[model samples]
Target chain A: MKKHPLDDYLRVARMPHIWCPGCGLGLVVNCFLRGLLRSQLNLDKVVIVSGIGCTGRAAGYINLDSFHTTHGRAVPFATGLKVANPELEVVVISGDGDLVAIGGNHLIHAARRNTDLTVLCVNNFVYGMTGGQMGPTTPLTARTTTSRGGSVDRPFNIPHLAAASGAAYVARWTTAHVRRLEKAVTEALLKKGFSLVEIVSPCPTYYGRMNKQVTGLDQMKYFRDNSVIKSGIDPKGVGIEVNGPIVVGKFIDRG
Target chain B: MPEREYLAGEFFLSGDDACAEGAISAGCRFFAGYPITPATEIAERMSERLPEVGGNYIQMEDELGSMAAVLGASWAGTKAMTATSGPGFSLMMENIGLGIMTETPCVVVNIQRGGPSTGLPTLTGQGDMMQARWGSHGPYSIIALSPSSPQELYDLTIRAFNLSEKYRLPVLVMSEAATGHMYEKVVIPPSGEIELLARRKPTVPPEAYLPFAPDTDLVPPMANAGEGYRLHVTGLTHDERGYPAMTVEAQDRLVRRLVDKIERNKADIIALEEDGTGDAEVVICSYGVSARVSQIAVERARGEGIRVGLLRLITVWPFPDDRVRELARQVKAFVVPEINYGQIALEVERCACGLAKVVLVPHMGGRVHAPELILEAVRQAAR
Candidate 1:
């Protein structure tokens, strides 16, 4: 039997993570651990910070120095860690609702300041932990608990937001494209000055059920069949729609 | 190693500038702040000075980010702080609760300007006194210091850092615009002469370290992040292991320790300056810039053959309740004057328990209470 490469990086005692099955957050964490391992960075000096949400639990599961800060606060907290001791590699892993909703100001400003930290925003289109409310990334006209009649508000184009706000490295990949995500994560980890990887993940339990992708596998198939890899295309032109062509590629890489 | 020069003698400095020097002298190595009136100089001074001392200073996006960064830096084994005023202080309340809940040691300076919401940005106000004690959502005790002058701001800021370190909680140095912007001669002692306090580090090996477990002093030893201690810090009601328990027992154990740690140590935490309270008929109670105004009032009252005295509070929270009770028994009345409408006066009234008549001299927050106004209150209380 082959040994799991990420087993040592997980807090096995806190296993059986709370992320719902068919949820992309678990895979995101898996790719994160794999990326951390593949990058060959000093694991002891890497700190994971997460905010409130189902995706926030990624900080606790990682067997490294971690902080589970307040809702929408992981980026600023990670900023402090990175600024205080430049030697430590700070990574912020949080859900769409947490990263861009309550924490939008921090996200934009951190990118603006070009603070040396990597941010992994897990975009599941809804607030998964709080029972799938319409979040900042929810596609327009998508049915969520908060938007039962279908959302009228426009959603954010996260990759475009990152690139516009001055992130040095910006990329997007769906969890179904595991290898691509792992590779993006590794590349992001090695880049300096506010790199962000927006992983378009599945929320089969909440976001999926409301929008009719009833199972985890159904959501995975959607990603496999619909995702388009336009590596050199402008990020501003790429925004997900209901069952839309999910854009997956490295969009920006610079100092 | 070269000898460090943290102090230069007898230069006139603003309270905000003095505070930055005070922080550097106290071994504070990280500062995160946003620019707000009455407090911007602290951030300005820190930005220029922190780098020279091998410390890091960052101007955050907002007060919320500033407070969060301070907490993060503190956990990374750096004594960290942030400074802001009125509007900025309001934004920082939520994370101040996080600092208290997680028992993070940091200093938050509110060089207060008048505000309900940016009511007076450049003017002095002591309106946030009660907010400082109860601004955060939860039930918790905090240590807040009030400084009357630039010299006191310099001295008390160091004490604020020391208290934050000893108790493992966020300590507030509450300065008004009058004090923060005022220029005065501040004598900063040599680094070796100034007593500094460091948080207790875990003595046990990494495997045995429980992040929130208390010692006899009720303060748990701290482990910095990235030190390979595998520390898990959270704002949730957590157990001694720093894991979220989410049970009644966990809430009781955690919340009680947080409050009791400061409550039990009030004797050592509280500081004040007293004059003629033993033989006085009426005691004038005040803090911050108001205390300086009250000093003049007390002097005038004494010359008028009134047995008036001053009880100037240096530590406002974990307030001098015991002293208030003792004075209420002997004195006929207490005269309280503050820049606010009537904030700390209520505390005085509560602690008096109606034993001594509490006379509040209120001001609507543009400037300090005139000495004549405080003197009139003292006269009325004396009669």
Candidate 2:
């Protein structure tokens, strides 16, 4: 078999990953790998930790010393790895429900302590693993299985929450902007204090089907057309609403 | 910058403080915990001591985070620990289950307080004895130790770490409010004098490494995160390769090994201090502070010309059922005294298996058993 370029970074035997056909997790992972390669981090010294979700499976797929932790616990688990061995670069990759909802306390506390960690939160707007339930990141009025009549609860603006909780670096990007998202990941990896990179990925099977976007391409097109790059904008003003303009950029860089 | 790693002297210390020192002596380099009554002093001591010994101390947001962090640190190739009381211990159950599933080596010190729900934050209770064994929602085995004095707390904390690393599971030091807050002289041995057991590291190269594959001892050698092994660990049921195998065969294989590792090694794991059980008419089975109280009762019963003996359980979880059964045949009745209402007594009754009568001297909590009450029970059992 011909070796793929990213083969060195992935667990080839664990291929045919469980992600759905048009899911944006693969693209986000690709961006992450490129960014990791571009950052020149010693692959041997990097560890990935993930909570329970579709994105959490990334830990098993990655070739690093990865840990698939319990639900909503990736941040604290990664925090442990980082604090115990400060020389190792620990990264937490989890989803919206796993991060901002059940794991909100740990996320805020890690940011408050400015614990050196990079958190990659894949915002898919619904709980894809549990059959499209309404999550903390679901845009208001967006339909999900739990929100068949449309959600009325306010969604958490992740970047704003991180910045308010004392994260030294915070950024938001959609899967459509792979190059920029990859750049953000590289920068977040290199940041000294707590850093957050929110990847707005498409969940075609759950979030997409429940809403009008039936395929990942539809969601990507919407992102491409609607995203407004507003670098240096206050994160509080970057909330996503139903059918609203998607604001994307690095909203905070303390360095 | 080279502060003394071991105190190496005699000092009066509370059980909580002694527990912290014991962990430091045992090479526990990472401490993550949340503050709760009785157990807070352990966290306090670690906060001040960990940095001096070049270790990490993190006060996590809650007990769940604290327990998760401890497991993470353990996988990062460091001996880690956490301390909590009843409420915090309840919060830690989820991650404790994770630690058990992953077979991570760490220490969890539960300074038990009175509780069905925040029952008594500042008082002692042995109520969590059953919880220690059966708390985490699955069929699993656990090792737990009870310390009656500050000195035992110091000695047993190191043993807890050793047992955890040896068996590749979380070991629980189940102390209660009485021992935790009691100040007594505790002797600290030299660093070289204290025996320490590190986790067994894999001998094979990364390509041949099976993360969950057991040696003859049924314990897999551990690899740290930064080591080139690239191990994958998960809480889900997994195969020897450390990949999730979601089948009944895999579940049976994994769960059985996890359980059998401790059960088959019970002789090496269980510890008890027996006195006068050879010809006694009545035997007192006790642990923690209750053991200390039962000693007085035993002596008084002896003064009254009754053949009474004391069985002090140092290792509580793998509850010396074999020893209990053997003694039950020779004794008329078994008197079990604990701070809780008949938790360990139920175990004693089950182990006796109708050979002898089991009497439980239950205390509601906040205090140890009255020596007279236990002595009265012993006197009646002898008659």
Candidate 3:
């Protein structure tokens, strides 16, 4: 019957969350909560909107004004909430497949409009919720359920895309870099006008296993070993390659 | 110029403009819409009017985003709406279903144009009647109202908001291109004189609140985003506590309540304008622009002593089945005229249930049905 420190910020009853073992989603949520606490935001005025995917369920676990919206629709839905009540802080947390694939148009348009929102994109490199299919963020040569031999198609460099589409703040961090990821989320939360923090998380049950990482810990180890911290680097040069060094940083910071 | 919250005077307005004014009067503080033909005027007027009244108007990327935005605003405890036509209406179907499943209150105005696929952009079409009822791909009921004139459009736009707030679901204002484009005198009443219904707010404290727990009226009291209540809303089949429940029993309970909230409350939801149907041998059933055309035909048939009458549908969704059935028992035949081939006529046929003959006068869209065509149908039905 021990009370958890974060219980006040979470829906404890809805606990034993639906996330799988060694899933980075929990880590991402932890970082987000830490960032939320650090930002000193009025919890009463924050609303979270998410689209359909494994990451979409994050809305339900948080004890705030949360909306689990339709597929690829969180950005637009959050846009509506923010525009209607400018006093309320709106954040969108959804997976890469939800935000960059079907919702790509909304993502770019929101950034173009410079709407005030913080978007936390959990990029597991594949569609983990619907089985490991090739997604827009899947690195080149990444194997998924659909990409049997290898993903022949080029993947999107999300930070580059966000920055190009007029995002005022764009950054990327992996689940292994929990402290940096938390700090990035905090900065994104406080920043105005279309901020995006891309969390390169692991999907051990699907994407990780398919890519030979075998376990979530292995993926975390890979991220820790391979990711190079490049502050203020150009987003265009930060695209991930197959087993290549990952360049992670805050790429865009414009008012 | 100073901002004016109420235009309390008579002015010439198109149906689309009147609808925007009506929404403003009805306390709709948030509007999100995409520009589409015929219905574009509503969004334009809203964009100009909303900021004047301390409200927000967002021109979303497309109708899908518009609909989604409307739902989001409603959750924030704002009266919200969106307007679109055929192609845009098709794009809104997914979020429309979300509105239904999440029991969110908002209004959608579909100033219908011709379409199997973008059939007519500038011309009139009543082809989206059935689509309004069943377009969202679900087993839930909907509330739809049809207006034949700018005055009715204004009045019903307010009613659409009221009904949506009362039922906690999306309400459709089904206007056609003819009504949308037509200019007519619209009387804008003072703000205090207009009756507006706000969403029911929860009575209990946040600790004891259940987001989907219905009261006696089957509508849960709503709490806005900034309120102390931490609400979790989703489109999935959820329990009364608003947690996703992936069980068959959960789906049945939730779907049934979503449907029965409107079905069981039909008497309060359905509205009809019955004119001269008491002792007529032939009753012409119609709605939207076709209703006005049917009225002229009825007047003509009455002049010719054919004993024809008109039943103008103000609320089209619940279908006024009881009244239609009662009239069917006394009438020899019923003539249904609509811009589309045969949408509401099929409803009439079902309600009539072999008690009377049903005649359908169909038009394929781009233009309203000529009075002569409806008169001809009425004359044949009177025989």
Candidate 4:
């Protein structure tokens, strides 16, 4: 039986993963795998850790030494792996809710330590795994299962948070920008300390249905039409808005 | 790799310092911990010492991070340890359960201080004994040790690491604040004299490796993270392949293996020191700091012509049930003195099974029990 090129890098038996239709996690995972392959890292020495979420399932699907840890705990667990075995490369791929909402303290502290880790955070703008609820990166005025009346809560500007907390590299892209997202992930993987690439993914299943009945195609069209690349922009000023241009680019690369 | 010395000659070290040295002797090369009272000295000593010996020491953001890191380091193929006090111990409960579920081998040192929440940080208390057994949510079993002196702290910490390696789970060193801060002469034996047990590594190739499959002894072999074993590890109930199996049958098999591993090895795991039990009517049962106090009280009782003996518990968890049950028939009464209100005393009473009168000499935290109070309890129990 012939194997697919990416088959070596995936858990084929665990195929048919528990993700929803129109979810962007699959595309993000594709980008991540391409980046890993391009980086030419020793696959044996690369470890992936994820907390609880749809993105957290990335660890379970990856054919690597992956840890599906408790909610909000992947950073600390990955920090441990890097500190203990400095020879290995550690990556944390989890959602904004798991990383910044409950696990926010760990994310900031790991950044402050300048720990050698590459974090690929998939921001779907809602808590996708636990039903579409308001998350740390949910855009203001976006409706969700929890925020039935448009959300009054201000969401985290993820890039700004990473840069302010001392990340060595920070970048943002949408799943629609697969080539750029993959390239950015490769760059982040090569960086030495606390690298982050935020992939603003779409969740047509919940976030879309709640907010304007936006389907997967509509979200993809929005990404294609509304995204504006602005490398080296002040991350603090690069916040997302409903029906506005999404500023996406490599904002910080201190290497 | 750099060559390093493992043994340091005899020195007057505190219990905490001795513990750090013991970790080094046991090949523990990774220490991740947060600074807390009583146990902070262990982390301080480790920070100064680990780098010199080609190991790493990290001061984590909190106890939760510390525990998580210890598990991570262990999976990365290093003997890892962390030291904390009451508040930090409480914070580590959630991840401790994770460690148990994943069958990660690491050492957690909880130098006991007074607490339900942050009570008497700089003082001694054994109130965490019950919490150590049932602190983490879910049905699971763990190995815990108590040390009465600085010398024992060194010896037992190495044993703690060995037991964790053997059992493929986290082993706890539950020392009191008094023991942690107390200074005594400790002899660091030559590296050859120390017995270090490495985790059983998988001999089978990556294709045939089952991360959670048990052997005859019911412990699965571990494969290091970078050993070409692209294994999946999760906190959710998992099968032998280490993949999540969300069923009652899967839960039963997984939880039973986790618990049965300890229960089947109870005799080998139980460690105690008994004296004068032969032809004695009154036996004084104690552990940790209370054991030292009870010794003094027992000797005083002997001077007063009472038949008193001491059964000091070195391994606290797994309860020494069979031994306690056996002593119940021979001894007339048992006096259990502890720094807590009455934690281990209840265990003694349950094992005594009404054949012997079990008296508790309780001390509310911040201090050890007075010898006279224990002596009085012994006298009353003897009567």
Q: Largest lDDT belongs to which candidate? A: 2
Which regions of candidate 2 fall more than 4 Å away from where they truly are?
A: none
Give the range where candidate 2 chain B is weakest over 10 consecutive residues by summed lDDT: B1-10
What's the CA error at residue A3 for candidate 3, in Å? 3.3
Candidates ranked by DockQ, best first?
2, 3, 4, 1
lDDT of 2 by residue, A1-255 (tens): 899899988988888899998899999889999999999999899999999999999899898889999999999999999999998999999999999999999999999999999999999999998888999999999999999999999999999999999999999999999999999999999999999999999998988888889998989998999999998999999999976789999999997
Judge candidate 4 at residue B147 and give its lDDT. Answer: 93
Cα RMSD (angstroms) for every candidate in the order listed: 1.6, 1.0, 1.2, 1.5
Residues B139-165, candidate 4, lDDT per residue (tens digit)? 999999999999999999999999999
- DockQ of candidate 2 compared with the true complex: 0.87
Report lDDT (CA) for all predictions.
0.91, 0.93, 0.92, 0.92
Chain B structural similarity (TM-score) per candidate: 0.98, 0.99, 0.98, 0.98
For residue B368, what is the lDDT in candidate 3? Answer: 91
Q: Write the residue-wise lDDT of candidate 2 on B1-383 in tens digits.
A: 46566688999999999999999999999999988998999999999999889999999999999999999999988999999998998888899899989999999999999988989899999999999999989899999999999999999999999999999999999999999999999999877888899889999999999999998878899998999899899998999988988999999999999998999899999999988888998999999999999999999999999999999999998889899999989999999999987899999999999999999999989888899999999988988
The C-alpha stretches of model 4 lying farther than 4 A from their native spots are: A1-4, B1-4
- Give the clashing pairs for model 3: none
TM-score of 1: 0.98
TM-score of chain A of 1: 0.98
Candidate 4 at residue B141, lDDT?
95
Error of 3 at A158 (Å): 0.3
Give the Cα error of residue A154 in candidate 4, in Å.
Answer: 1.3
